[model samples]
Target chain A: MELEELKNLWTELSDELEKQKNLTDKIIMNMTQQRYTNKFEKITRYESVGAVICFLVAIGILWKFEELDTWYLKLCGGITLAFLLIMPVLVLRAIHQIKKLNILELNYRDTIVAFEKARNHLLMIQQFGIYLSFVLFFTTIPVASKLLSNKDFFIMEKEFSLYVLIGVVMVFLYFFARWGYRSYKKITNSAENILNELDNGV
Target chain B: MTKEQKFTELIKDNEGVIFKITTVYTNNESDQKDLYQDIVYQLWKSFDSFRNESKISTWMYRVALNTAISHLRSRKKQPGGSGIDKIVQRATENEDQEFEDRLKILYAQIQKLNVLEKGLMLLLLEGKKYQEIAEITGLTESNVGTRISRIKQKLKSRILKS
Candidate 1:
């Protein structure tokens, strides 16, 4: 069929579809106003809940920081408390950037550009989250060791191999961080490729 | 009336556009219905932002195309085989075979095009001008012309071969 022929057929098809009128106006309107929350919106809500939990935990740790006997433990607690404070704001800001795309407000090209920027920002936040988690994991080691050292039973274990324990923890952290990075990259890359295809018209 | 009521009225008027678009982009009836709901949902989601800057039909075209494209992309990420064949077999067991055959052929040809090609072709099929197609698709007028010409040739060859 030629282009004109295909166009004619399309018109006929449209006419057929019009005659079908498969759905009621009420159903369409209901769906339209349905407040369809997508995956990203749900994820942001979960992140907000997590942010609250992080804030509470940070406050709890800071409250108990004075109880620590060692200077290093106090320092670790101080750094972790600072991280907990800063991390949520970073997370929230990334969420804000993603939310700001508001596809309904922008033109096609601008929407694609805005979505790309938001996804990239989100990818950066994911990377930062992974690295910060690794840093926190390492920092907690000494704090944990010191807290355990305070226990009389822990003090009795003079021949305990703290180096071996740290080595095992480090290995575990490495694999855990790698897995997190891979998952984030997979999601962001999928989104990024879609944007690229849109922008480049591939 | 209120905004919701007005928007509902507008959608009802342009309901043909929704069905045409959804049918063009999706292969099966179930996917078509899914895409139709998604387009309506997106239109309503973005309706408040629909300033009188453009014709309502134009704005609707843009939003519908955008939503359909995004929906297709997300579906690509996690594809599941459709049960549309069984559904069609059951629903149209006694329907007009001629109309069904023609539509099946038309949709088969359309599904051969890539996502961008499909969008451009759908707009062309709707009798949109190059400038209007460009406006909705974010392509330059000249680019739209070039792509449409190329797509036309590609479709011609495929149709002839078939």
Candidate 2:
């Protein structure tokens, strides 16, 4: 089919669509009455729960400050506490960037450029998240052990079991980070391919 | 008329654009509805910025295209996220088998185009000129011309092969 034929087809569909005309005034009002938010609500809610959990965990660790005895345990606690305290800001900022997109601001602007910048912003957060997984793995083991069972792996009499546990945690963190990176790539590869297509002139 | 009434009227007039853009951007059934509502919400939010009737179509094109390309597709059918799934289905329901088949083939071809090329081809198929396509897409007129020609050739070859 030539472009003209395809266009005729498109116009035929358009004519049919015009005849249908079923977006009632009530539906439009329901959609645009400051109640119908965008498609990011689920993930934003997920991230919110993640953030709240982080904040509460940070609070719990801070309150149990005295339990983290010894120099190394204190160091782990501090690292965990700092990450838990700071992660929510990074997360919520990314969520806010997505949720609070003002279309008025994008009117007549270079849209592809804006989209690239937004994707870069989201990727940066996800990149940070992958790195934070490593931080979480190392700090979480020590802090969690102390908080949950007071089993100080550092001062425990046995060393071989600790090695096995470390190996298991290492594998876990590897899979977790891989999941994060893969998730980010899945979301971005579509846009990336589009930009590549534009640049490649194909 | 009130601004809300005017916006509603304008949107009703251009709902076809919204419906078509949603289908172009999404292949999933539910995602199309979600995107349709999202574009409507955005157009409503940005209505004040583009009240010039002379260029309203251009403005709508810009908003719709921008929202579609930049939309992050996710699962959004949860309760309270939106109550418009049925609205979208009913709004887009077509009973004619011939029209449905033609639309499927058209969408299949459109889905084959790359994202930028998809936008350019859509504007072209909608009969937008190079300069207005330039205005809506923020591409130079020459760039739009070159890309549209390239897209046409690409489509021609694809359709011929098929």
Candidate 3:
């Protein structure tokens, strides 16, 4: 095609593209909203599972030392159990606030944005899990000691061993959480780089 | 100018760039819409980095072509049959004698080229110089000349037979 002919063809194509811009923008907007919603839901679900596990742990500890009758012991156990049960519910409610949005299948840029948002959400949840595990680990010692003292249920050596076991588990959890976050960060960064290249027209 | 105003001006001025790339790269209504939107979104995301180094139109072309090439590569791995088949079928069914039949034929032929060849022909069709084409395509100057000559001959024979 001659230069003029190519220019004319491009002009026609440009007119068509202009007409479609509003529609494209709407689709991208929807996709972003949906991505945020999906991330919120996934994070909520993970948190809820964590909360349930904490609740079960609290119940097991209580059952193991039924002989503990002090008011202080009862108060501490109840407060811990209540916290375990409530935190996940709060996270789930927060997730529900995330809006659902549409993503156009053919739009590669929008698709990349959606994927990046998802990866970030996953990393955030992983970090939250790590933080929660640490909180539980540090608080468990004093609570466990109180219950044991109230009941006179175990020798000092046995109580110390239990604390050591809990410490080991906490350390393992911390390392695992850090690894998960690092892997997710790497993937997200690579994906973002590809996105930037596309944006740069490279 | 405000960012929104600048964006509006860019769209108004370069709408054709988006359209031509979409038209050549996609065959159907849905695919056309998809490609068009993808191009615009990419442009919007990259608008900040456009350092006035080259003509905006040239930058647009490079981005559009790169995105189209990547999309084509990914689509090739999809399990279903080729999407171009539907486009060919649609063109055959369109009985409008007023439409440029030669243009449709040219598009069909262009679709058959490999990704690199398609990029070259796309630039060639746009009347870009061999040097500019080499810069965009990462091919040496002589290689670009040889490829364009070869492509021209091939297209001429195909047109003659048709």
lDDT string for model 2 (A1-202, tens) is 5778789998987886787788788999888865445556777888789889999989998889899988888999998888887777887787677656654455323565556557668777868877887877788888888888888966667678878988998898788778878877876787677666555543
Q: What is the DockQ of each candidate?
A: 0.38, 0.46, 0.06
Model 1 pairs in collision: none
Query: Which lDDT tens digits does candidate 3 get at residues A65-140?
Result: 4544555555556666655666566555444432231232222234344445554554565456556757665555
Clash counts per candidate, in order, are: 0, 0, 6
Poorest stretch of ten by lDDT in candidate 3 chain A: A98-107
Per residue, candidate 1 scores C-alpha lDDT tens digits across A1-202 of 6788788877876675566555666887778767455556667899889889989877767766666666666777777777788888887888778665555655555655566667677777767877787678766655555554553222345445866876787888788778878877876776576567666752
lDDT of 2 by residue, B1-162 (tens): 998899889889998878888877775667777788878888887887775754888888888888887677654323321222222233434556665656666777777777788888888888888889888876778888888788788888987887
Per-residue lDDT of B73-133 in model 3, one digit per residue for the tens?
Answer: 2223112212333222222454433234434544666676544566777787777888777
Q: TM-scores, in order shown? A: 0.70, 0.84, 0.43
Candidate 2 wrong stretches, greater than 4 Å? A107-109, A157-172, A186-190, A193-202, B51-54, B75-95, B160-162
Q: Answer with 1 or 2, whichever has the higher lDDT.
A: 2
**lDDT scores for all predictions?**
0.70, 0.75, 0.56
**Isolated chain B TM-score per model:** 0.82, 0.82, 0.77
Best by lDDT: 2
Considering the two chains of model 3, state its CAPRI-style docking category: incorrect
Cα RMSD for candidate 2?
4.8
lDDT of 2 at A77: 92
Give me the runs in candidate 3 sitting further than 4 Å from their true place.
A1-202, B72-96
